[model samples]
Target chain A: MALLSLSAVTLTFAGNTVLNEVSFNVAERSVTSLIGPNGAGKTSLFNSITGFYKPQQGSIRFDGTELLKLKPHQVTKAGIARTFQNVRLFREMTVLENVMSGAHCRTSAGAFAAILRTPAQRREEEEIRARARQHLEFVGVWAEQGRIATTLAYGHQRRVEIARALATEPKLLLLDEPAAGLNPTEKHDLVQLIRRIRDEMGIAVLLIEHDMGLVMQISENISVLDHGEIIAEGTPKQIQSDHTVIEAYLGRDDGEAFLDE
Target chain B: MALTDIVLQQLVNGLVLGSFYALVALGYTMVFGVVKLLNFAHGEVYMVGGFAGFIVLSLVSGTLGSGWSGVAVSMVLAMIGVGFLGVLIQKIAYQPMLSAPRLSILITALAVSLVLQNAVLGLTGGRYVPFGADLGFGGVNLGNLFISYNQFILVGTAGVLMLSLELFISRTQYGRAMRAVSIDKDMCRLMGIDVNRVIAVTFFLGSGLAAAAGTMAGAYYGSLWYFMGFLIGLKAFTAAVIGGIGSIPGAMLGGLILGLLESFGTQIPGIGSAWKDVFSFSILILVLVFKPTGLLGRSEQERM
Candidate 1:
């Protein structure tokens, strides 16, 4: 059974359709990639799934919960966590604090508990700190946890963002353009990290990427989106050979040469 | 009196006044930090808090003997009441307008302020209500300086409140969430944080601090008026700006500095006490011109 299923999800902004009847399913523990050219509504789909953009028509179900009815935070609580296309770490917070904030959903301490410093609250805080540190270490940014998040190198900031997302303990992770601005080394490390997140942590990943090499290497299944519609869904080999996907990407019939490269 | 003694006395006075400003300024800074809105109704919340404290005091003084304990009880109750009021105001007035233009929300804040002021005016017939309790009657005299019990209570309470707030922001789960939301609201949501709840809590803390300041101000000044929140609110805002509008420590420092400036500026041979406000506002203008980000405020470039 699918861990996440989106059926006929439609989103419109100011009477202009942004996403039109987009339907796909991410299987449990599977690595899936959504690939499309620019302005193909991949991020918009992610936003809808995360409850930032409420789709006008559709059902989004994750683990039997209707995510369409939930708010963004509720969606995160419901076991779907995502990193933005652009790194969005809290600029004012230290790297450790940034990841610790992700544990906020699982922790139940409120303002009063904190003000009074109850024993349970203290224990929970220690646990949260430990969990955050563990994720930071997993992402290989544990040494930079004391520095301000935005002050780090761009690649380190991206890793911190992923660790922060991982700290949420989501059943499924959505990474949008994770390799967008990385050097080759960072990209390779990110691929390894994504595999570790799925293989070791038992989390499924749904990625949106323009890097065909990364997508072909990492994704078990691929869904091709163009003009807000999914034109093809299959293995990376099938997508690379699909005439519609090739046409969508190269806007010509000779795109098979491009896909082979 | 010797010049040294006079300066010392003014220093004490300024510290007392600065405490109140810092307390209220915390509210401005915290609210702005999270929401990036200049909550004009904040001062009215402070004014309402003064009235709330006054009412609580009136009700409990007969049983509690009108002592420091009674004042403490009143302040606590007032903090809670005004904190809820602040939350309600945010939910009803500000939350809906979160997506609206900045000008519209600001105007709405002004409207809320007017509503609060008029409501109080109508209820009390626009009269100056005497605070009735004289908490400052006694004092400790040291050398040429005399510090009243009221000053002690004011400074002591404000100090404790500010310290508690600092701890709350730095160490608590909700506090960290508040900081995160301030930086990036959408990212906080992705972290499974209820941004609305964080904002509501921000309003609660900010309003509560202002309320504590209000209750103390009422006791110190011995009077409460419908218009009391106006000037002080502006001054607290000035303090927030001076300290950096989104910075908690900056607000505290700004408030103390503004208070000291007011205190010392009043003693400038020809200026006299009448021009004290002139000095306060002049400092504000100078800060705006010279250090627009205030003493502790980070530059936009640095923050970005």
Candidate 2:
């Protein structure tokens, strides 16, 4: 069954339609990829699902809740978390603190409880710290958890961002170009991590990636977006052979030349 | 008095005044940290806090009796009231303009300040309202130095408040969320933190601290006026900038440094008391000219 379903989501900004009648479903515990050429509204679809941009029409339902009715934070609270295309760790915070901030949605301590350090607040804090450590360990950055987040290497920072999102304990994790800046070895590890997140953590994954090799290897289902609409949706074998997707990536004339190979 | 004795006395006075500045400066720094808004009306929140405490003291002194206990009750109540007022101001005035241009929000802040000032002026008829709380005029004599009981209370209370605020920011979950929001608001929302609530709490705590300072200042100085927040507010902003505007520890340090500078600057034979503000402002200009990030502030690259 689909954990997330979008029906005819249409988003327009200042009379310019950024996303038009886009529809797709992310199955529970499945790895899905949204692939497109640049400015094909892939990120716009993610924004719509994450509630950053309210679509003028259409409904996004996640885990039986209408996401369009919720605020961005509320969407997160309803078990959706995402990472940015660029690493966005809290610069001033220690690595562990950045991950701990992800526990904010799941934890319930208010300002007064925190200021007073009530017994329950203390216990909850300890739990948050433990969970953050676990997520950091899961992403293999546990050793560097004490250092400032921004001081880390680019790859480690990406790992930290992943851990931070995982700390939110989302049912579905959205990763925007997770493999964008990684070395070949780092990309290999990310594939392993994505599998672990699905197989072990049981969190569904939806990602946007330009790396066709990584997407083909990891994605169970792929959706291709072009010019504010979905051009195709299928398994890796099906999408790789889709004539329209080839035209979308390569121009009509170039697509014919590429198909011969 | 001997030169050494005069210096010692000024040191004590500087500490007392520094506590107030530090308290008020925290509001400016914290609000700026979270929203990057100057919140110019914060001074008026402090002014309103003073009036709130005054009203609380007047109403309760008949029952609680005007003593240390009465002042305590009044300060607590005033802080709570003014904290809510700060939140309300953020919601009604600043929050909507958050997405507007930076200049527009700043103008709104100025408008809010003017409105608060005029509102208070109309209520009090621009007259000095006597605080009327007798916090005792006694003092401890240490050689040629005289330190009042009120000074001790003011510094001790401010110290405790500042320490607690530091702890709250460093150790609490909400505090961590606040730090994260300051760094990246949109990303923080992905972490499921209600960014609006964090900003509101920042205002609440900042305004509450200012209110505590306001109540203590009224009780110690024995006078309150509609325009009281104007000069002090600017001085506190100076202190925030000096401490590195968004750094919590910086605000406390800046307040103390500014207070000491003003205190000792007045002792110069030619400068005198009237030139106190001149010295404080001159230091602000110097800090801006040299270390624009303030003493504790990191550069933009490090901060963002």
Candidate 3:
């Protein structure tokens, strides 16, 4: 069964439609990549899925539970986690502290327990620290745990953002332009990490990527969007040859994405 | 008194006042950090804390006797009461203004402050209520220098509160969540944190400190009135800015620094006690001329 399914999702802002009846599903333990041109509404779809934007029409289901009814925080608790296109790590916090914040939904130590330092709270805190360490090591950022998050190099920042997301232990991890600022080696490592996350951890993965190279190499299934609508959905070979997909990006063959800021 | 003894006595006096300023300043800084609101009503919160403690102590003393323990109970109860009031004020006054402009929210805060102050004035008929002359505790003296036991309680309570606040921010899960929210409220929601809840907690803790400070102040200064929080609120906010408005340790340090400045300047030949606030603000002006972002503000590249 699909872990995340969005059917006929429609989102609009100020009378401009961003996602027009967009539909897609991510099967359990699968890799999905969303590819779109600059104005094609890919990020909007991610926003709707993560509860930042509520669609006016259609259903979002996570493991057969209606996800549209949940708030943003509830959506994370409902097994979906995402990273921003630009890294949003707490700049002043240590990398480890940033990642540990991801454990917030799963941990139960509240204000009173934390203030009092109850034994169970202490145990929970210890476990959270250990788990954060595990995710950091998994992402190869264990050594940078003590460094300030913003001080890390660009690629390291990406890894820490991913590590923070992973600490939430989501069933479907959403990556928004994960390879955008990465150098070739960092991109290569990210590719390997995403695969390991799916194969070793058995987590469903969905990402938005402007890098056709990374998308074509890493994704098992691909969805292409143009003008707020899905133009094509298929294997990489099918998407690569689709006339509509090619025409949507005919002028921009460099396949690099730049943000409007 | 000799100059040395006068300076030392003023130093002790400075610490007592500094503890109050630091406690109240923590509230101002924390609220500003998380939501970027000045929360002008915070002064009224200190006033309410004082009045609430006065009422509680008065009611409880008749039953339990006016021992030091009764005063301690009054302080705790007042802290909890004022803490909740802070949360309520946020919900009613500031929460609705989240998307509004800064000026709108600030005006709303001012209105809330007026409401709180007037409500207390109406209830008490605009009179001073004494917290009693003696806390039933003595002081220690060394020749011409002396320090009251309440002064010890004042400084000690402030120390414990600030230290615990530091620990709570650094070591606890909610503390981490609060820091994350301070960075980005939207990102915190993505992390499955209830941003509203974190904000509510901030208001609770911050207001609790203010109230605790007010209760202690009332006990130390010997009375309370509806306008008691007004001047100290400004001073505490100045302390927050002096230390770096959003920095916790900065608020504490700022409070102590402001207090000491006021203390020492009062003894100066020209400034004297009458020019205490003028001297304190002059120091703030001098410091800002050199360090623009306030003491521990985020813009400082070099922490030293």
Candidate 4:
């Protein structure tokens, strides 16, 4: 069953159409990829899903829940969490703190409870710390938890961002260009991590990527977008063969010659 | 008085005065950090806190009893009252103009300050209300120095409050949300944290602290006037800027530094006790010219 469904979503900015009648879905626990060259409106799609931007016309349903009715935080409350293309991990905060902040929605402690340090609040806090640590360990950032987020190496920051997003305990995780700034080895690690995330945690994963190699290797399904439209979608083998996708990536002639190997 | 006693006396007084400035400055810094607004009326919130404390102390002591217990109870009530006032102001005044130009919002804050002052003046008939000392609420002599039980409450409660605020922001879940929201409100929303509530709660905590400090200041100074918070508010704001506008510990440190400078500066022959405000602003100028980021402030990113 589709965990997230975008029906005829349209978005426009400054009278220029960014996303026009776009639609797609990720089934339960499936890894779906949205790939396109620059200006394909991929990030705009994520923005719309996360409630950062509202679409002019469309229905966004998540597991039978209407998403448009909710606010951004409500989007996370409705089981949708995301990372940014350029990592936005509370820069001055320690890695552990950044991840622990993600657990905010799951807990309901007020300012007085915190100031007074009531027994219930204490227990909840311990739980939050333990869970935050576990997410950090899962992302292989436990050792770097004490370091400030912005100080970490590019690859490490990306993993910490994932851990923070995971701390939200979402049913559908949206990763925008997760492998954007990684070296080849880090990319390899991320590929395995993404697979484990779905296989172990049983959460649906939807990603926006420009890395065709990473997308094709890990995605169970791929959707190709260009000029604000989903040009084609299929299994990796089918997408790799589709002339439409080839044309979108490489102009008119399909550029079959470039991938002949 | 012996030189040692005079020096010690000034030191103690400095800490007490600094405590109030620190408390009020924390409110300024916290509000500015989140909303990026100066909230010129924050001093008025402190003023309302003093009046609330005065009314509560008067009524509670009249019926229940007097002394330290009465003072403590009044401060608690005042903190709560002024805290809600802060929230209401945020919701009605600041929140609406959040997207508006920053200048207009600052002007609104000034307007709020004027309105609160006049309203209190009209209500109290523009006369100063005298607060009477109870049992130990009055000052005690320490050799050549004068220290009030009100000072104990003022300095001590401020100390406890500052310590607790530090711990709360560093340890608790809600506290973490505040820090994170301060860093990035947009990302906080993506993390499923309600930005608006975080802001409202920030105002709650900040205003509550200011109110508590204002009440203490009223008791220590022995008179409550309609315009009392005006000068203190500006000084406290200066304290926040000197300590790095958006920093928590910096606000506290800034308060202490300002108080100490003012207290000691009064002793210098060339600079009379009346030059305290000049002394305070001098530190602000020095810090701005040299450090720019203030004592513990991490970034130049925080709004001026």
Identify the candidate with maximal DockQ. Answer: 4
True contacts kept of 3: 0.91
- DockQ winner, 2 or 4: 4
Per-residue lDDT of B1-304 in model 3, one digit per residue for the tens? 9988988899999999899999999999999989999988888899899888888888898766666677788988998888899999899889999999999999999999999999999998999988863575588988899888878888998899999999989998999998888888889999999999899999999999999988888888888999999999989988988998888999999999999989988877887688887887777787779886788887734323
How far off is residue A160 in model 3, in Å?
0.6
Q: Write the per-residue lDDT of candidate 3 for residues A141-240, one digit (tens) a residue.
A: 8999999999999888988998898888899999999998888888999999999999998999999998888898999899998889988999988888
lDDT of candidate 1 at residue A216, scale 0 to 100:
94
Using Cα atoms, each model's DockQ against the true complex is 0.85, 0.87, 0.86, 0.89
DockQ of 2: 0.87
Please identify model 3 stretches exceeding 4 Å from their true place.
Answer: A252-261, B300-304
Off by over 4 Å in 2: A252-261, B301-304
lDDT of 4 at A41: 93
* Best of the candidates, lDDT: 2
lDDT of 4 by residue, B176-236 (tens): 8988888889999999999999899899988999889878877777878999999989889
Q: What's the i-RMS for candidate 1 in angstroms?
A: 0.8
Where model 4 places Cα greater than 4 Å from the true spot, the runs are A252-261, B133-143, B301-304
DockQ for candidate 4, please give it: 0.89
